[model samples]
Target: MATKTWKIEKDLCRCCHGEGAFNNLAEPRTFLDKVEVYSDMLRECLDIDIPPVPGELCAITYTICNACIARLRDACNFKKQVQDCEQRFMTLYYKNAIQGLKPATKVKEEIEVSIEHAQSDTDADIVLKKEDEDDDDDNHFLGGDDDDGMSDDDLPIKPPKQSVSTMKTRPKPKPKPKAPPVVKKLKPPPKPKKAEPKPAKEKKGEEKEEFTLTVGADGKERFTCKACGKSFNLKPLFTQHYRHVHLKLRPKLRSCHLCNEKVLPWLRPFHMEECHGLPAPSCGACGRKFAFPGQVARHQKFFHMGESAHSCEPCDLKFKSRSEYNHHLIKHGDVKAYKCELCDKMYKWKRGLRMHMLVHNNIRRHVCHVCQEAFFQQSSLKYHQMKKHPETV
Candidate 1:
């Protein structure tokens, strides 16, 4: 009997069992030497512990997708927040309990200190009043002999001073007389000046450029502009040149009635739905709405009308639209017409080249609604949703 070999699938998420771009948990370089380990976080948040397997059994990829990683982070943050809140609550509870059990002796001491301060303030005020009365009495006895034509030795002996409960009140000074107010006559307002007449503006007539059409020997008509002396073979080209170059007018644009914004004819549909909150154009046959008019027309012709205008002989495939048929033909011929400007990468279809160019830029337009993970391509976002969040799809 021949030995059989089995192929083990590795591109799967350990948490959600989905496949897409995944981050390796076993590799340290993939985590950028972060302190928090993926396995530890999973165990902490979801209580899902991964066993430590030896390097010999490393054939399986211990990886997690972007969506799963986002979920894990949210779970970890929630757990940390709950733990912190519990710790804070317990600390506050203990503090309040300790404060409630404080001794009543400290409260009694605080009341006694406040009463002493009030008593001290009253006593100090009474002492200051007595000192002021004594100083006034001594000054009154000494002031009388200064103008009495008597020396200090010839002065009569001072009598004993009687103690007064309060000091003598000082006399109030008289108020000065007020001056009379002066009045003056007011001047009349100045007269208004006469207005001057403005000069009349010159009116210039509009210059009309006449275009003459001439038939060539080969029966091809040519248009010649008289203003700039430019010639064009087509009538539309001549009209466009005359309007832009001679009249200085741009091409006519349609203005949105709701927003009053001018937009090109081709981009009007997109602007209406995106800006004005209008519904996309729907098909009358199936009542199915499409983002663009081209999609609605294709849907009506392919499904409703059962149109298959283009067919492939080699593959026996039929496509309703010519563009789709051309795209199908490129696979058979292996002809790559679209080339990347930044890097010389080639693609068979223009859309393939457009999606490939996103690798050169950092733009992630498609985003997951569940975990809010962004992707460069819409297909990648769809795949992530199908794997990680099947319920949302």
Candidate 2:
């Protein structure tokens, strides 16, 4: 495998302009050493993979400053406080800056201390080897077995001589003084301090209100409003309170068609339904009365409803359906199409033809069977039959 050497580019930090310690632009050897130490420490402790760059030497030229690093560190530390300082630092650095590099990997700091200890032991072993080499050199300097040796019996002995009087007399040895005995003064252990009582916390200005359901003696459920804590027997009152207070809506009134009484617009149909004795909606085409607007709609749909009512622009005559209107539009061939039932004397619409036919058939009356009610128009006879003899019909 090839050897790789890491290099950091001298880029001025954008945040601090190369003034802060985080600025990698500084070329000081001490600063670089410290950075390498910290980086290696973090890599080992946090399992952080250094961002790899291609080539034998890689230069880091990123744009994060010391202030941001410190902030990110505090943010991660406050949430993940650990006993180990190196591990805590690594966790902070890796979580914010390098989490994208490798996810869900953990590291430890204890192994770094062991590595330093091993390095020191290696250095100590080298010193011991050098000392042993020096000792071996000293032994080689002494006489060895290869050197010439005299016979052991032929060796001569030196005679002992008496001390000379001319030598300078040695001074008598002085009596040695002894050290004073140490007096250890023992002190009493400190007394434990009493814990002070904490102050009570202040209450908030606004209190949260709760709404609950309560059963009454009448075996009916009552609703309570969260705002006022008041109980309402009727659900409408509860709804009104919610709309009036919470929604802040004003009550709107509308006049009822049946009784000419002012009522809530939403309740007008119900009022018409309940007030049967009051004046009801009367059909203009058939002269029939209904109790409510819904009933009138049903009556119109079942009795007189058509595809589309068409009226002639020239004669003001209305046709019940689109087919009849189209048939009657041929009189003013340029403007409409109209057909006459009695004769070829085409008019703009059927009404003009009917008016002209009235001269021929003037007796327009229908007699009812049960009441013998005779009316000039068929609609009048129908009204009489439905109102006077409704059960017989």
Please write out the lDDT profile of model 1 over residues 1-393, one tens digit for every residue.
999974545566777767666776533222332334575577557867554344643335567778877777788889999999999889776445323343333222222121211224455568667777987998787744567677777868796564442324342343344344444444554454444544665332233336886654333457888887888998788877877776777667866655669987556656857995544567788788665555666687678877778989999888976899987888899778999988899888888886786677655667776787878777898999999999989
Candidate 2 on 242-316: residue-level lDDT in tens? 776766675778654335588874455357457733234556689776434445554565468642347888887
> Which RMSD values do the candidates have, in order?
31.1, 36.8
lDDT of each: 0.66, 0.52
All candidates: TM-score: 0.22, 0.17
Best model per TM-score: 1
Clashing residue pairs, candidate 1?
none
